[model samples]
Target chain A: DAGITQSPRHKVTETGTPVTLRCHQTENHRYMYWYRQDPGHGLRLIHYSYGVKDTDKGEVSDGYSVSRSKTEDFLLTLESATSSQTSVYFCAIRATNTDTQYFGPGTRLTVL
Target chain B: QKEVEQDPGPLSVPEGAIVSLNCTYSNSAFQYFMWYRQYSRKGPELLMYTYSSGNKEDGRFTAQVDKSSKYISLFIRDSQPSDSATYLCAMTDNAGGTSYGKLTFGQGTILTVHP
Candidate 1:
């Protein structure tokens, strides 16, 4: 509930197609994170950004990429979608003062 | 073994009952512990966070951490239907370096409070 929003709450794309998910935040937090949720795996971090033009790979960074050009927006892109990439993606923002991370509504993507 | 382990339960309980959820971790370096509540088709929301160990209470919720046992728990008193959701446990080491602020999470436990 930290003024975070993820676009295209739901999407379905065929395999080998490019897909992009957008996360926008109004809180102006310095840190933003992208995570994918799947059964038995809980939530796995995909990528994160600490500031403008600053980014880092997470535990499950394969087959995906991220960019942060502005403090309010972080983008996650899949160069080519795969069946294994079908899952719920969540965006989170961590305030500079606190260690807690607030999340966006999330996006559900499917690959055929 | 995974760094954090939790029972993925669809525990069902009646309203007003006390609910307990737990998570165990293999890493002793984790210093920051957190609990998040996630509803179906929605992202997770932070419920509680504690640093180091001991007990922290907030209204109907209480979070306990035992660093020695590498275990943590979240208790809900007088649970309500609105409290039905998947509870995820997460931890991190804030001691700096590249791992700072990076969280490792448990598989999560689903609880349903029926009215």
Candidate 2:
């Protein structure tokens, strides 16, 4: 509830297609993260940005990429979608003053 | 072993009952502990957070961290139907570098409070 929102609440795309999910925040927090939630795996971080133009790979960053040009927006892109990549993606923002991270509504993506 | 472990339970309870959820971790470096509540098809919301080892209370929720045992718990007193959701336990080392905002999470436990 930290003024975060993820676009394309639901999506279905064929395998090998390019897909992009957008996460926008209004809190102006300095840190933003992208995570994918899959059954049995809990939530795995994909990528995160600590500041504008600053990014880092997470535990499960093999098939994904992320970019942040502005403090309020972070984007996750799948260059070539795969069936195994289908999952619910969530965006989170951490305020500079607090260690707690707030999440955005998730995006459910399916790769056929 | 996984960094953090939790039972993924669809625990059903009656309203006004006391609920307990737990998580155990293998890492001793974790200094920050948190609990997040996630509803179906929605984002997770932060419910409780604690640093080091101690008990922190907020309204109907209480979070306990035991660094020596590498275990943590969240207790809900007088639970309500609105409290039904998946509870996730997350931790971080608070290393203050590249790992500053990174958190490792446990497989969430599902709770349902029936009216």
lDDT top scorer: 1
Residue B41 lDDT in model 1? 91
Error of 1 at B90 (Å): 0.7
TM-score of 2: 0.96
> What TM-score, over all chains together, does every model reach?
0.96, 0.96
Model 1, stretches more than 4 Å misplaced? B95-100
Tens digits of per-residue lDDT for model 2, B59-114:
99999999999999999999999999999999988844444478899999999999
**Model 1 chain B, poorest ten-residue lDDT window?**
B93-102
Share of reference contacts found in each model: 0.62, 0.62
Kindly list the per-residue Cα lDDT of model 2 for residues A33-105, writing each as its tens digit: 9999997789999998989999999999998999999899999999999999999999999867556788999
